[model samples]
Target: MKITEKTNEGLKREYGIVVPNEDIATKVAVKLEEIATKVSLPGFRPGKAPKDLIKKKYEEAVSSEVAEEEINKAVDQIIKEKSLKPAYRPDINVESYKFGTDLSFELSLEVIPEIEIKPFDNITLDKFVVEISDKEIDERIEFFANRQKEYKNSDSQGPVKTGDVVLIDFVGSTGGVEFKGGKGEDYDLEIGSNSFIPGFEDQLVGAKVGDIVDVNVDFPKEYHAKDLAGKPALFKVTVKAIREAVKVEINDEFAKKFGQESLESLKKMVRESISHDYEMSSKMALKKRLLDALSNEYDFEVPSKLKEMEFGAIWKQIEDAKAKGQLDEEDKDKSDEELKAEYQDIAERRVRLGILMAEIGEANQIKVEQKDLNKAIFEEASRYRGYEQQVIEQYTKNPRLIEGLKAPIFEEKVVDFIISKVKLNESKVSKEEALKKEEEANEPAKKKAAPKKKTKAKKEEE
Candidate 1:
């Protein structure tokens, strides 16, 4: 057996392998001898068959199997001897193979690059400290009170007014032709709600019960129904009745309606909920600042394989959005060249940050506990509301599903670990300002989305 390097470049290796004819013959002979002992025939007893007979019947089958096993072993041995970690399975080129000829092949592969970790103490980052404000708590209380409001028939019922619910029957048409889904009976519409087409609800104001009136409205230019978008429609509306909402007294009885003991208890629950939201928002903002700082601190070329994988995932998402008719305005206008350049930059940044974060976590000996993974999974499952138990049970039964739950948790832990070692300066900002900063940071990437090539299948459905 002989092995020679064909090429050695950055993160890539190729080699030529050759097994001499002598070795092939040696292996074939051994296989033939083993088969000879076990051979049986119609005219001969078991273990009494000749070598010539075995070779004639089973030589081709045994030789092929032996060659396959030898090639696999040779490939594994070469990788082990070179201390190579392939990013993907090797591409094998079988140059030649036969019973009495030399077996030759080429193997080409990309290797996982070695990571050089930097010290954590040198990194610096900013940490946001957001205090839960009293105004926020009051706003939450007002929202809860609105949810508890009750509706009653209006006392002054001469005409329906804003904030009143009107029960009506109506048929609508555009250009004197009735459209599909344009007719309904006894529809309860809330005036001033803006739930219908623009100007539809406003025109219903000051209308008396049993009064049939024609209401005109223009459908929005971006209406989901393509046939009716930007079209003028007139509805023959008859107001049958009118009702108004009355705010419920925020006392113990109102609190008990939601399964709470008292109004004070309900208020306490709302405050806690608001506090939790603030805590989560602050933590996320702090993480972003920390990551940005770390990225600026370290300098290294990210592995191209990592960048390609990330880019592929992002491109898949873009394609899916285009399929759903949810492509953003900027995406609809982008050329292929512009989108590729933008997405390529995003891929490089993500890969570089990911590798840097992993290095920091490994150097610091950071670890994610089983409890943390389980808690994250449970929290995610709870988002499904009533199906939480079933989701939990399903994940618990599959190890791969549990791993899917743990990857993001582990990534976040690594990020947090880096944040802990960095010098973090606290800065306080208003909610609106922080949101604006986040949006500004995302603007550049948002403007470069690629206009996907529309598929015939998608167009047919549309």
Candidate 2:
């Protein structure tokens, strides 16, 4: 066998390999001998078939199998010689081949680039911190209490008003005919809630008790009921009673409704929840800054194939969104080439940062444990409400989705490790200021699927 370098550039390596015919013959003979022991022929006992007979019977099939093995070994040899890590499977180019001739081919591939790991001390970042204020906690509690507001019959028995609740009996019609789900009796409708069709509530603004009102409204074009969408309707509304609006007071009795022991306890829980939200915002802001800093500090060539793979995934999403008429406004009028060029940079950055984060995790031996995965699965399941157990069982039984959750978890751990190592200057900011800062810091990120990849054994994201 002979091997020679054909091309060596940046992260790409190409080589020409030639294998002697004798080697191919030897491999075919060995494979045929093994198959002969298991395969029976018309006139020969199993394991006792003559070599010439076996060659005649299985040579065509065995030769192809042997060729594949030789190609694999040749590629393995190239990787072994230089410890090459290919970004994807090497491309094999074989212009011609036959059973009794030298097997020659060109192997081309992009290698994973070598990344430099800068010292942790050299990276400096500002960590935003938000200190929760009593006012914020109070506001959160008030918002929660408002969700459970009560209403009572108005003492004045006057005309209905906006923000007031009304009891009504009504039948809705389109084109002088009543429609399905058109009638309600003693139904409580809030004037300003916008729960009913547009203009229905506003038209009931001056109705007194026992007054019958005809309300006209148009169902929204995007209304969920397709049959009624964009249609005009008239509702015969009867004002049964006027229910005045009421806001729940912050009291221990009110707190008990939510299972809290006292108003103070409820306020404490509200404060904790608000603090958690602010903390998450602060952490995200800090992480964005850290990622930006690390990306700025590193300069290395990423595997072109990997970048292309990432760009392909992003483009697929763009195409899908376009098909659904949900594409971003900025991308609405761009040519394919223009969109590709714009997103290709995003792809490259994603690949570069993905590689950098992976290298950092490897250098520090950061790992995602099974417990971490369990926690993530639990959190994911919680989002679906009542199907939590079913979701948990499904995720537990399906390793693929669980595996999908790992890259981000691992990236988060790497970020944590880097945060601990780097020089972090913590600055406390007001909740409003920190939120604005977070938005500003996060402005540049695409906030979508990144180029998450596992090298060698696993497939890169499509």
Q: For each predicted model, how many residue pairs clash, with residues at least 3 apart or on different chains? A: 0, 0
Model 2: what TM-score? Answer: 0.82
Given candidate 2, what's the lDDT at residue 367?
Answer: 92
lDDT tens digits, residue span 1-462, model 2: 899998999999999999888999998888887887888888888788888888887898888888788889999999999799888899999856788888898999998888879898898887777887888888888888877887677765657888888888999999999999999998888899998887889999988988999898899999888999999999999988887667788899999998999999998888887778777766776776777777778878999989988888877777777776777676789898987787787788778888899888887899999999999999999999999999999998998998999998998999888888899888888877876876675666544224333211111222
TM-score for predicted model 1 compared with the true structure:
0.73
Clashing pairs in 1: none
Measured by lDDT, the strongest candidate is 2
Global lDDT of each candidate: 0.74, 0.83
Cα-based TM-score, every candidate: 0.73, 0.82
Off by over 4 Å in 2: 39-59, 98-102, 155-161, 168-187, 197-240, 318-341, 439-462
Candidate 2, clashing residue pairs? none
Candidate 1 residue-wise lDDT, 32-87, digit = tens: 88777787877899878877888888888887887787789888998999999776
Each candidate's root-mean-square deviation in Å?
Answer: 6.7, 5.3
